[model samples]
Target: MPLPEDAPELSPALDPWEGLEPSGGQGSGGGRPSKPGPGLHLVATPIGNARDITLRALDVLAAADLIVCEDTRVTSRLMQIHGLHRPLMPYHDHNAAKVRPEILARLAQGAVIALVSDAGTPLVSDPGYRLVVDAVAAGIKVTTLPGASSVLAALTLAALPTDRFLFAGFLPPKSAARRETLGELAPVRATLVFLESAQRLADMLADAAAVLGPRPAAVARELTKLFEEVRRETLDSLAAHYAAAGPPKGEVVVVIGPPTEAAGASEAEIDAALQAELAHAGPSAAAAKVAAAFNLPRRQVYARAMALKAAAP
Candidate 1:
């Protein structure tokens, strides 16, 4: 993605920290008084590449009274790259409860505080929900500086249906719980987006295949960085590939196409599958297997399975 010809050229001469008074605050020596007024600014950081961040985000970060982030080390590296030296504070799942009140107090005092995650947008499977809620309740101004997100990036590369979609975040680590979660999402009419761990990628895909049938999906890794990869295929095929190749390195995002009429098993096909499974397994077991294989509702499959058994001569 290149900048437009009409777009302003970004150079060292174009300072990102132009309009702001010198800071007399905590964390760092170069604390700058924010010009954006008192508010909670939710900034979106780049997911992978260092340069993917927006110009507006940089400005807000530079002008913020204090920068609250998931990890100071991670945020520090980003700040260093763009020649920014703002006061950085740690605020994540473990420390949000303790630090949120202090942040709110600052916001109340007309301090422009910028909240950001390690990457991407805040509150999208990231922290900062409670802070936003508290800020709003306290009548403090809240705003967003949206930029790069792995969810949208993967969807773009997936070539899947995008008109309607859901970002379900990460699934359960265990197989049983994960399958149950996938079963719940099996009937969704829109495409699905998920962030997954590298080690659990294979297992997650396996459960997804068992519960979602053979929907078309894509596995995207290391997005926007060198060695970025997107493997698009059926859910079952992806499961098999990961099972064989093991998990790849870096962050992962999985995009699955929505359910389709063509993907649904026919009544005859269901009956045949049920009959075959019932020959060796009990009704409950047979239904579970068939329903999972077809991505159909278990109760629906079980009812038909019982009918077939009763009608058997």
Candidate 2:
């Protein structure tokens, strides 16, 4: 299909997903439905596989008067594949501050606007958070068409505990800053998910290994597409493997397992360490130092140290 005037340019080779026609039920293809009020729709697009998008997302995209996305070309190509078109407006980090007011203005005029990222869900390691925040504050209706997400995909691919998981988004670029962030999350009981570039994958994994210990981990890349691969191994092994092999191409999702039970120090072990520190320094200093080292509360360590002191002869 040729690109629409409002759609972005796409590769000459149309994706296989493009072959699938947009469903009739949703506002896809046919025409916009008559919704009484205008609202902002947060649409989740496919991460790698074009067919991964939801029917509702296509309907909203087809129905919405304006569709705001990170990259017009990227979204335009996808829309072209599905044979859907709409006014594509740029709403990315670079120009978010400037374009946000315009989007709000359209919403005020009862023009339904759908926000999408280049891939995956918007505001998920992507832009659109500010727009959602502002829209909600203005009492503008907001709806989410949940669909493909790299974080959820990585979590499923990693086969880690999902009852509780934290999406830390992308780590800092600087080694020191990245390490600092990892250190803060080291003791979190929930599995951790981070979006990273293939180039920085090795370094990020190494820092995670150092700060979070040798936990079980997985690296998922090219999610939901041909040649999609997910590798599960120990943190040290992954760090070493990626470091030697260099970063792989395509998008990457790094999922690290939570601290193992064995790694969680026993009370006796902690008390011993606390006793040694308390003997060398005052209780407060000892508590502060050990707490920082273990990512624990100083108050908790201070209480433990006091208990140890009382137990002493």
Candidate 3:
């Protein structure tokens, strides 16, 4: 029977020990076997398109004694698409603590386990970190089969400076808390990346604009899928657009450009801003906020804040 149209093409079989001298091992008297060696393998699944998975990732998935994933149903579908049928175990946030010990025990017994998330790389805002940490602490080998990541995908589409960038997974949902978080991130002189819910996109963009000013930005959604879209605009413009449009469909990633040199703020202007922040925050916090807002040095702002504090009645 012919393979399905969506099925991955298979390469012709080759001898596993074709190019090796005998080291007293497995195939042909000492060569690597077709199977993955025993240990934990952090596998990266396709972010959206199932075909985005790497060849080596498929190899590990095929050879793994067991596959540990965020959602068995989702991973099962991916396996089905790729014509794989490994035993899968659920290892998500809710059950990780309960199941980790069992996984570790199996690893201790030399099981080749492949760890994968529902989408993208394992442990990127997923529950795999603790497992990796435990695996390492237990002296078990841990390695990664890196592949598709939404973070990188969004950044690539954002058209912003990528040399210095930060991936801040997600922001708080509430407006006040989210704004505070944005305020804290204001001083970072790099492109900022964040994953957010579609429902919160407008509000998040608004808060970002309010805190980060009119920096260039892009909001990428449905990445790598048929409907993938990237909207590049200034922070305020994106915020306005989203507010008017009332959020969008699918997963959202916001990439904001780094701070640009603003016209230097006068002493009076800095002092006034400092006073406003100090009313609700400590001098240090106030100084940081003002410094970030004005693109001034934290030490300079802090010193001025202290002076203002000393001079106050």
Per-candidate TM-scores read: 0.74, 0.74, 0.74
Backbone clashes for every candidate come to 1, 2, 1
Residues 128-220, model 1: lDDT tens digits: 898899999999999998998999999988766666789999999999999999999999888899999999999999899888877778999
C-alpha-based local distance difference test score of model 3: 0.86
Candidate 2 at residue 36, lDDT? 27
Which lDDT values do the candidates have, in the order given? 0.86, 0.82, 0.86
- Which segments of model 1 are wrong by more than 4 Å? 1-34, 263-313
lDDT of 2 by residue, 97-149 (tens): 99899999888878889899999888987669989999999989998889989
CA error at residue 88 for candidate 1, angstroms: 0.7
lDDT of 3 at 81: 100
TM-score, prediction 3 = 0.74
- Model 2 lDDT, residue 286, Cα: 86
Where does candidate 2 stray beyond 4 Å?
1-37, 263-313
